[model samples]
Target: MELAEKLFHKSRREKLSSMLDENSLVIVLGSTNVARSYDDGYKFKQNKNFYYLTGFNEPNAVLVLAPGGMEVHDEKSKKIKKTKEILFVQKKDPLRETWVGRRLGYSNVKKELGIDTGMVNSKIGDVVADLISRDKYNKIYISLFDLNFLTGEVKEQLRGFESSWITLSTNVQIMDVNFLLAKMRSVKNEFEIEQVRYASTVTAAGFYNTIQMIKPDMFEYQVQALLEYHYKELGCQDVAFETIVAGGNNTCILHYNTNRNKLKSGDLLLIDSGAEFNYYNGDLTRTVPVNGKFTKEQREVYQIVLDAQYDVIKKIKPGVKLTDLKKYSVERLKKGMQKLGLLKKGFDVTKYTLHGVGHHIGLDTHDAVANKSIGKNDYDKLVAGNIITVEPGIYFPEDAKEIPERYRKIGVRIEDDVLVTKYGGEVLSDSLPKEIEDIEFLMME
Candidate 1:
């Protein structure tokens, strides 16, 4: 079986046993795309939540598990559960296969996906009705919103069952399973970590290729194209997100993705981009001088961002709160700004310093998870095997007249993917040239 298939079964079993009530039925549905016209159609990626649970990457699939029928009494006075994992996938369509590609048919899915049973999608309505017909089940656990494809079918099945109909009239439960899956995916397993590492390696290679091809007169989008081309050449199907190739003052816009400006000799180029592999992503940002060497002011601000990054890395160990790390980066940035005279002595750092120092990185570039509060002792502590990015930046717009002329129109950010560990945080993207001297050397070479 494939690695993704194994992960899918394990995650599904864990979620079913942990989240479902003793006599509840759970249904997980995926999205589908309908044809706009007779000839045109849209492609669909499997829902991340559904894919996490079943590793069924195909569209138009549903997973059903019944908690009541899954339990068995053990001689040791324990109730051993035997949850049935059923996958309903699209039936084999020879015509469609010729146009698109062959799907893992029902028989292949059962053997390869490690599911107890497999059925064609056409039988989903009846199967769901039968599962709800069992009076022992008092509640149904299904994803409430965003799964529009199966909402009507699910509601129809519930309405058809007499017991469910009676319960719905009064107060039968319809529990939402989204939060349960979110919590499960928040933590990274060994396999997930390895996949992220591979993504990071591919992203770093893309960055290297970009550096070699970049010239002062080239457009920012050209640099972006270079990185993306390398990403594809190295096997990444797409970028983790829109590539940020902001030049000069444009870098001040943190989420800048319109890479249209022309690179100049004195301008600093900020490239914040990543590559995705197997749905895992790597986020990396590096600001370099377009002329292959930073001017005095650019170097000063760049070094400060570098120092802030180093400070966060030095203290990022198990048990450190993310909030503390953010505070530490802010303080370091403030101090660095004061040293360069960009900020006045005792000025509030919050006015200039914005955006969080880091975020969880994985399936999504801005991967969703619970965030920690600043100065709060109750915040979640850093744990080993967690993958995150420490991105510290300072943006000074061209119009800002508060500081030296040399420093104006400068935006500097240094980012790297890190793996939290018991001993310390390991920098996964250390291959990128970040140090002032090292960056210059790489550019010149």
Candidate 2:
């Protein structure tokens, strides 16, 4: 299903209501971008948090939820409560639609979004003012830090009636809605998981296709072009992030996106890329030898990274903290590097294994989660339905004299997307070959 079709408003409202005390009014603001000149014009993407809550992708919108309103009786003798959700949208405009695009006015928004009521944007000031004027609602919950159109207008209204008897007595509180929204988006729903799976599948195809088309003499940019072509052909809206096509010694740079290098006979090419589908993303990385085969030294380093990655994958399940995973992977890398003699008897292993093994992936590549620190007993357990990456890498530059001569100038990273589950972690991007023999075979094809 399309993102816009999801019924996220109810869950979002529940979360907001849970956070707020009784008698509070919460307002979310969204607006269209208006450039000063034609040359500076740009398209606007709907705020991810706002879109996550309401599934409203259009610009110039507001969502209001009043928790403490007077209860009235209806004709059926049932208690008909006051409005819980009120949406304000842009008024219909023919001229604007001609230049830009058609907008679903108030009527359509109410029916489609399942809100209690919908109104014109022009009347928002009056409606909000009246709602605040009521003496019963003492606490007002407005997203203070957001400087969008609705927030600015609400601020002006609050300033306008600051001296009035009703407004002066009312206690208004500002809440950081961004934090509340981030917590909501950390866990993935069934629909969201499905969309992410589709994106991962397409991304895997792109990686496989790009690898098959790669030649020893091809420019890195040409390989990047092939990956992009496959992404588009597989119906990806766009790349999740800039494509990284680092080759040879350049792979030592973690985020090398400059695809200007030439693939030599003995160099390894590393690609870290993914595709975006329905605003969800999939992240994967694979490193392969440019000449369809890895040198003995390259295979040694590659096998170690692969082993670390596999060990982490086997331990991924519910209640697995990211910190423990990091420690475990580091220990494995340290042992592997020790066997290879890269580290002396007691040298700190972190010097070689620098970055974290993985991170959350979703609407944004680095999606939010509860874990803030990597402590020994950190309780940020891996919950079911959360998508994460398991990437293990070893980078050794040419200047590092401690390593063997053949192992120098070699960087190998293998990453894959995984979905946490109750039984065990499911490897979403398993279609891509990670084994040394399999990669060599595919490259030969």
Candidate 3:
């Protein structure tokens, strides 16, 4: 990591420490591996909050942050020091190292992660217990997710803190660390924006590649594979979320990921997928005709969704409420649908205009940010550095008798990642074509 990158993590830690009240400690645990089968396990992914604070990747690591300084013995230095931050990492094991990847090893924590103190995780359990029992800190803030999935020495020592890391463990008031982390993660620094931008950039390339290669008779999963190839080919860890390559009637299913159907000439494909770059993610959705040409009815419906999306995106500056934006998009889509005679006075536009206009996209594709629920999302205005998606979709299932045969089984969703700016919204995935003419030209090429 560069100096700026290292400073980013350090500054976040400092800011969080400032947010803490005196006589309190915050404990956050990183993620551990899960077994895919009996022999091997899935890839280890560090908790986003932990990574934000330390940029450390190793699992079974615990981070302890005290508002005021605490005196602790540093094994590597063999000296007593006052520090507010301590990291407990795995001890060195040559055999384990040979089988799995190398550990950061506690001794290198300060140098590598910039934490003030480092200790082997083996002693963390007793250390935490001793501190709590001493009554020095009146409150403890721990990551709720980690508290549930505790393991190793920490779990053994704090065993039964299950009600809260250990059932009836201590008198200290326990609080969740997620609330603070959510508020902090909601905004982006320049580095985080760049991470998402690059991810969106590559993600756009992935869509660009997939749309051109798609043809009648190709399996939907094959298009998914070609799209995911952009993940590895463009320096990404993986797809941030499941690649939704829904075709024909499958497009109406909001969270559909069963990409097994064979594509037909007239059927449209709705792809809502993203790529992960450095944990920050890029979410995008684009619906294109499998035959490389949209019939007149298909073009009309696509235009309605596209125009509504454009109307919503233009209002994305700071101080604008997302819910208001969502409501506005809903109204705009209804008006658009009304023109097609699809939305009448009695009909609910929601049947076709499924989902909100957009959402904040970051560490997770749906992001671990604030105001996830439509009406109650953070209840705060969007400030600059907040990245969001603008996706307005219309889905029409084939069975709907009210719909014309040509427009039935037609679903259109146009999505792009947008960074909320002081001036206006900047589309990060601009490199990928969204205009109907552009898409058709690319397919022709």
Candidate 4:
């Protein structure tokens, strides 16, 4: 890792350490590689929470933090030093590296990751249990993870120690570290904002260049392939999530990733995808005409979603409540649907316009932060440095007999990543061509 990134992670740890109460210990586990099939494993992905703290990208690692410094005996230097952090990583295995990948051995971890002390991860269970048994700390903070999903030498070793660990936990207050990290991650730092902004920029290129190539008779998966190709070509290795390339009636199904169907001439194509830059992610959605010209029905629905999204994005600023934004979005969609004769004045708008207008976007797309309760209160109020998606969608299923035939099976959603600033919301994806005329011109070219 680069010095700048390592330092940034160090600062994050220090900040988190400050948030912890006095005489408390926090333990966070990194992700382990999972087997894909026989004799093979999927690509290893580091835990986002662990990466946020340590910037180490290996499997079966554990991070231990003590708000109050603890004495550590350095085996190499034969000196005793005080430390607030300890990182336990895998021991080097030359044969394993030859078969799989290079290992940043435990001995070199402190120097490489800017961590205080480094030990072989196999000792984590015993080491942690012993620490807890000593009963020096008042509280122990453990990062929450479902044990059934975890697999690794450390996890297996910890499983053996569960009885003792549970016994220790019964005496000390055990806290889930997610809430603290969630609060810290909700507000993006300068580096995080830049990464998210650049991710969006790359995603826009994927959309702009690929959308022009999308024509009738193409399978939905083909469009998904082209978009992902563009993202990787721009140096983004992984997508924020599964690329949704729903076309025709499939567009009405939220989270539809069945990209096998061929797109028809008069149908609309909705591409909801983003790229992950560094660790930050960008999220965006765009609906366009498969034939490069929207029909009268399609344009009306698109305009409604677009206007509702624009209004919601405009309201993103520090101190503004997301609930209020949701309320306003509902009203806008309801009014537009009423004018189109899709609904009566008091009819439930949620039947057509589903989901919250947006969500927090960062390390994980729809980041680990709360989707609705984004504030300190239950109704999350926006705060400066919070980057969220402003997505307003209107869906009319094919089977809905109450709606107009022309509008049936149509889904229109306009989404953009917006940075909540003290000044107001800044559209990180402002460079994208979302205006109807702009989209038409791009497709025509």
Candidate 5:
């Protein structure tokens, strides 16, 4: 990380510490390495909350924030009083380091990362037990996900410990800390905004590279591989989520990942993918002709989706709720579909539009604070620094009887990343051409 980036993380930790009560303790657990096979494990991803607070990516670590007046025992058994933030990390093991890589082992964390103290992971349970045993803390904020992270033996010990603690202490309480982190993460700071911008740029470049190389008879996975290869070569560690590259009718299947079909001349290809940079993510989706030219039916459906998406994005600003935007999108689509004679009597949108119109994008592609409900007015108000995706899609299955035969097996989705600003929404992905002529022209090049 750059010096400025390191300072940004340090300031974030300080801000979190300031939010705590004087007698409160916060424990955030890092993610563990999940086994994929015997002696092999999947790539470890640190908990987003832990990373946001500490910027430390090591697995099996815990960040403990102790506010002022916490009691501690010194080497001589003397009672010491101080406020401290401690990082409990894996103990130094020469054999393990040899197998993997050198661990930042229990030293200089304070000097390097601005943490107050560092300790071995083995002593975390004992140290935490001793601190709470004194009844100094009135409230304990713990990651709810941490319970799932414990090993079997450690979890058994924790169950027993909780039972004993419940019997002994009436004032101490455990509370979910994720809500606070979610609220904090909902708004992007300057540093986070820059990272997301870079991610979006890379994502767009990858899409352009793939679209230029796309042609009839190319397998769907080949396109995905090409885009991902471009992303990795540009220094991205990993994708934000599983890459979705669907061709023709496969695009009707939301969240599809089986990129096995060979592209055909008249079919459309839908790709939904994103890149992660410095832990922030960019989500983008684009549907284009397999032969680089949209047919008549494909163009009609694509135009409706594009118009609906544009209307929704134009309305974004501080205090605009996503639910309102969704409703507006439905109305826009309904009117467009009706004008095009796709609607019969009622406005049943599920026939064409399948999923939600948009979602907040940040640390997670579908960010933690993105409103998830379909209730009429249930949603979060957009705020400046909030980054989201405006995606509107229409899918027509081959077997459907309501639509014309010419429109069958067509899927079109136009997605773009937007950032909420005081003036309105700034389209972060505006550089990527969504206009039909622009796309065809670029493909020609």
Candidate 6:
């Protein structure tokens, strides 16, 4: 890790520590390996909140942060003054390491992660129990979820200790650390924005490459495989989520990932995917004609969705509310649909235009922040450094009698990752072509 990123994570932990009252303890538990089959396990993904604070990726680890003025006893049982931070990792096991991978052990964690103290997992319950018995902590903050990965004999002991501590101490309060961390992560820092931009660049490249390769009669899984291959070749450890390569009416089913159908010549293909760089994710979606040219009806609906996306992106600036933007984008789509004669008087456009226009994107796609709500005074305001998506779509299933014959079974959506700025919004995925002419030109090869 770069020195700057190390400092950035350290500052985040310090910020959280500063937010707590005196004699407060924050417990962050890492995720454990889950069995994919009998003995083999799925890839380990660290808990996002734990990764946000500690920058430690290993499983079955715990990070404890105690604010200043907390009395703690070290391994030697000697009293220590001031703040304390301890990271507990699994002890070295040659057989386990040989089977899977080498363990970092406690010594390396302290040096590499810049943690104040590091100990084996077995010691955590005893140490925490000692602190509780001594009445050293007034407030305890733990992960909000009932984490399935957080299990073992050590954890059982700690759980027992916590239950007893709560029963004994009326003054001690337990709080959810996830809430505090969510508010901190809602806004991106400079390093985080840089990472997102890099991820966005890679994501756009994958889309452009796939666009050039897409052809009539190609299987949907083939397109998914090609795009994912490009993402990995460009240096992304993995995709942020499952790649969605929906062609024809399959595009109407949002979140469709069973990419097994063949592409039809006149159908529109929607590719909604993103790449992850250092855990930062870039979410992008684009729809294009399968045979490199749109028909009259397809072009009409595409243009309307494009206009709505373009207008929504223009309104993305600090202080703008998401609800207001959604309403504005819907009105734009409604007018466009009415002009096309798809809707009668008083017909609601939202019937065909399902889903929200966009959402915040960051460490996780559909970032943890709440969207700006309905009321003018009751919404979250867009702020600089906020990363979001601007996606607008019009879906018409084949069975809809109200829909026009030519436009049936057609779905078109255009999405881009945007970074909110003081002056305006910056398009992070602009490298990928969204214009009709540009897309056709690139696909001509």
lDDT tens string, model 1, 1-445?
6866586556656655667777777778776655668978755565666766677777677777775564322222345435466677877899998988777776676578877667666666766665555456677777767444543333344334434445563545777776566556657777788878888888988998788667889999999999999899999888888999999889888999989989988899999999988778999999999989889888888888998999899989988888788888999999888877678766677666678789888777877544454464333577777778999888888887776777888988888999987889998888887889988888895
Cα lDDT tens digits for candidate 3, 1-445: 6677778889999999899888988888877676789888888888889899988888788889998877777686778777899998888899999999898888888777778788888877767766666668877888877777765556665553443445434566789988888888899999899999999999999899889898999999999999999778989888898899998899889899989999988888899999999888999999999999988888888999999889988999998988899889889888888888876578888888879888889987877877644465543578999999999988889897777777899889999999999998999998988789998999994
lDDT of each: 0.77, 0.77, 0.85, 0.86, 0.81, 0.84
- Which of 2 and 5 is ahead in TM-score? 5
TM-score of each: 0.86, 0.85, 0.95, 0.96, 0.93, 0.94
How much is the lDDT of residue 268 in candidate 2?
A: 94
- How many clashing pairs in candidate 3? 9
For candidate 1, list the clashing residue pairs, or say none.
none
**Residue lDDT tens for model 2, 179-252:** 56666676788878887898899999999988987888899999999998998999998888889999999888
- Residue 254 miss distance in model 1 (angstroms): 1.6
Model 6: clashing residue pairs?
Answer: none
Stretches of candidate 3 off by over 4 Å are: 151-154, 160-171, 372-378
Runs of candidate 5 exceeding 4 Å displacement: 73-81, 152-165, 370-379
- TM-score of model number 4: 0.96
Over the full model, what C-alpha lDDT does candidate 3 score relative to the true structure?
A: 0.85
Evaluated at residue 185, the lDDT of candidate 5 is 81
Model 4 scores a C-alpha lDDT of 0.86
Give candidate 2 regions above 4 Å deviation: 1-4, 31-43, 69-81, 122-130, 135-170, 345-347, 373-379
State the displacement of the C-alpha of residue 403, model 1, in Å, after optimal TM-score superposition.
3.9
Per-residue alpha-carbon lDDT of candidate 5 for residues 17-52, written as tens digits (9 for 90 to 100): 788888888888877778899989988888888888
Order the numbered candidates by TM-score, best leading.
4, 3, 6, 5, 1, 2
Residue 189, model 5: lDDT of 90
What does candidate 5 score on TM? 0.93
Judged by TM-score relative to the true structure, which candidate is superior, 4 or 6?
4
RMSD of 4: 1.9
Candidate 6: where is the Cα deviation over 4 Å? Answer: 69-83, 146-149, 152-154, 165-169, 370-379
